[model samples]
Target: MRHRAGIVTDEMLTIPKWRFAVIGMLEALGVVTGMYSAAMLPGPAIPILNQTFLLWQLGFSALLLGRRYSWNKIAGCLFVAAGVVTAIASGSESGQMLSGVGLLWPIMMVVSSAFQAGATIIKESVFIDAVAHLKGKLLDIFVVNSFGSAFQAFFVLLFLPVLSNLKGIPFHELPSYIKSGAGCFFNVGASSGCDGSPLLPLLYIVNNIAFNISILNLVKISSAVVSSLAVVLSVPTTIYILSLPLPFLPEGVTLSSYFLFGSVILVLGLILYNVPQHNNIKHNSDSDFM
Candidate 1:
């Protein structure tokens, strides 16, 4: 259906195939390395250090796209970084400190995040380039997403051996392990001890699909940096949602005092970042008057 609709064809793309392949490879590398490093890192450090991706996105947008950000926008990004770190570090009950884990994993996590940020920027560039090259026609978001995800899946298969080892599953047993996991996921076979089964994982899969689609659509209409910032803003909301008592979860943890303070800072940062550039607005108004 997508092919018939002209969404999957190369004719819609502005960039060459090799360049798109490179972007796909970047996406795959980012996901694989991010998962590997995250598996090694402690729980708290994951969120705290992941805030680096925002800065990386901002930097890449400037360096690669020749986009200049105002000082307030940069500061707003910092506020967001600090707010998330404060809320996550102080609120989590277990392993609240990052002192135990060594520096290697944390460094790897940041690098992996940079890879993802680079992919995001490059994808945004594809959209921007398409406008000029496609006779004002916009590229379909799925063309980017489907290809990127297909590449990622291919890379995952290639990296399965290493990932299985990291996950403590024997390389040979990986297939069986996944089979059993699938059985549990579907609530079939003799897979015991899978209480939640299909519901939880289905919800997770659905939610992830929706989130990625939404974020990719956001990138289609806005700059990559803006989409990244929008994701950063979700940290507080996720925290709040997890804090609430839900049917599926055990007793939900109450929001800490740090959450309130950090949320305020996060909101302030978003506001600061979104403040319009005076020069751009004045130029637009002048054009309108003319």
Candidate 2:
């Protein structure tokens, strides 16, 4: 991860604007991947079973830093859980099962999100420490992206057999609705069936560099608090769009009261989770961890 961040930092010297593009792409890829997973899963559960991991990530991050859990952070985790519930509640029991054993998509998203959130925390420490040591943001970015890619590459290669199955394959026919839906999961990479997305990994690299810049710029031009909230506006917009009648999303999929309730909770949780706390942070925070 450190290596990846370092490389990205170097690229900034040649092209600083790439960061914004990268951020937008990364955000789009994650959201698109997630929506695809929801369409593919049984009962079309959004947030699925993997929601547990995010909660765990929140807890793990807290423990990793030896920080006591504040009510806001705890509530934030709960809201993340609630968001998943809302997604599930909005789904149907009679949803379609995925054609192949492609469980890796959701798993990848969860794992990546965990790494991402943790890295965000750790990078801050690195950047601040770099200030005292005269380190640069470009170096820090490269280090994060490089290592993140390197570590995740193992999984990509390990899942080679699965990817081999789809190297030149085509997806089975999709209903016209899904094919045309704005939230459709078409054009999945043919790298592997289980989760062989060279595209995803590459996108991950590009995305880290991008959003990291967006956040930095956003904070630079304004403040961390403002940038953080601005980034979240996409959530409810996604939710609303997903709930609406659309040509691409399956017609049978319906959002329930429970799902809406859960979604609201999730929104709340996320809002709380990101709230900066004076008590939760301590001295000696570093870039190796967040």
Candidate 3:
């Protein structure tokens, strides 16, 4: 559509400033906090965080978009949540209790999830409004993402003081932190002798960028709740992948039989959640033909 409309210019690549100021800032905070929390926390806590994200997305979608959920959808979400909890609980490293400082990280993750949900719903709402005004112009996902990511980077810098404090870095040492980060990025200085393959961080950056793009596209096509659900559905796949014996791992991790059972339940729940929407689409198609 953009090509046909000849709207592929630099101006077309920009999201509205107001929307970026609001939604983009929230998304940046969410992305930064979510990544920071995960790095500081343990693997077991991630499932709980994912559940928190799902619930928050549902709530945000409902409030922001006036979206209604059917009994099946609710049940499906609950089942997926339960399945993830069960799988993670069974597979998490033994004896690492979530107490004291551990508990704080999960709470932070939940807060991050809430910010993400809010950003997603707001972006979706903006897309909807833009589509309504489409006279011959295209609604470009890249445009929204470009502006949103720019604002996100700005907010990340703005919150550096708080993040630095959380990391126990003195405010005066902020320059040193940046220099150290740059050194690590280029495999130079003190971080040059790190044992891990340099490809790991490169892969992570690629994955994170792709993930943001996917989330934005998902929000554009559907509601934030559905995007969250799509992520919820990936839990099992992630668990299974982790179970593999990769070179980075000291040993092959074994998953409990319960993980398989939970995986099945998660798939079933996702199918249930989509049943109503699928039927509605099919019904509308039949009516069109009739």
Candidate 4:
């Protein structure tokens, strides 16, 4: 149907091959490292670390894309980081801080955010840079996504041996481990650890794919910073959901008493970031008059 509809454009085809390869490689590193580090970090730490990507995104967009922001946007990013940290810290148990073997993982997570942010900025640049050559036509999201995914798969294959060994699995034993995982995913294996089985995993995969596509589309339509902001908005929602009583999950936990206070600060930061400043409005009015 896509072929019949001609969604693939000549403009998309004109994008440089190296661009896609770069995006794929960077994003692959980010995903692999991020997942590994996340597996090691405490649950409460995940949201806090994940939100740090907004800082990385802002930095990369400024450096790579040569974009400037108002002070409000910058403060908004900091508020977001502070809010998530405050909220997560409220529920954290004593001795839950990253230390010992866990210390390196937190650093890796931050570095992973750098990689992801760099890739996202590059992706945005692909759209921005293409506008001139394509005569204002934007590149197709699928074209970027498909090539990036293919390259990411290649990199993931290359990283598998090292990744497995780092996780304490022998390289030779990795195949069996993956096979056992597949079996468990299908619910046909003898392993009793497969609780939700194929259904839950499949649903998770579907939802994740949709979420990623939406993020990419958002990046294409707006700036990389905006897309990162959208992702940041989800942190509070995730924390709230985690506190809810839900089936197929452990007993729900409550948010820390500080959650409301942090949330208010977060909301204020968001409002400040999004609402146009008086100077900006005056400038826009002057431009219109001229």
Clash count list over all predictions = 0, 41, 0, 0
Segments in model 3 whose C-alpha atoms lie over 4 Å from true places: 1-15, 31-41, 91-96, 101-104, 136-138, 277-290
The whole-model lDDT of each prediction reads: 0.78, 0.48, 0.72, 0.78
Q: Give me candidate 4's TM-score against the actual structure.
A: 0.90
Could you estimate the TM-score for every candidate?
A: 0.88, 0.47, 0.83, 0.90
Residue-wise C-alpha lDDT for candidate 4, range 53-125, written one tens digit per residue: 8899888776776666777778877887787677667755636466555578988998899888888988888
Candidate 2 runs further than 4 Å off? 1-43, 91-143, 158-237, 245-254, 270-290
Candidate with the larger TM-score of 1 and 2: 1
How far residue 149's Cα lies from its native spot in candidate 4, in Å, is 1.5
- Estimate, for each residue in 1-290, the C-alpha lDDT of model 3 and write its tens digit: 65467755544544357877787688777877788888877767766665877778777777767766766777877888877777777755436646544666777788888887788778877777776556435567777777778888889888888888988989999998888777776667745454453577788899988987897787776666677777877777887887788767657777888888888887777777776444443321211100
Model 1 clash pairs? Answer: none
**Order of candidates by TM-score, top first?**
4, 1, 3, 2
Candidate 1 global CA lDDT score: 0.78
Q: What lDDT does candidate 3 reach at residue 281? A: 35
- Considering every candidate listed, which one attains the maximal TM-score? 4
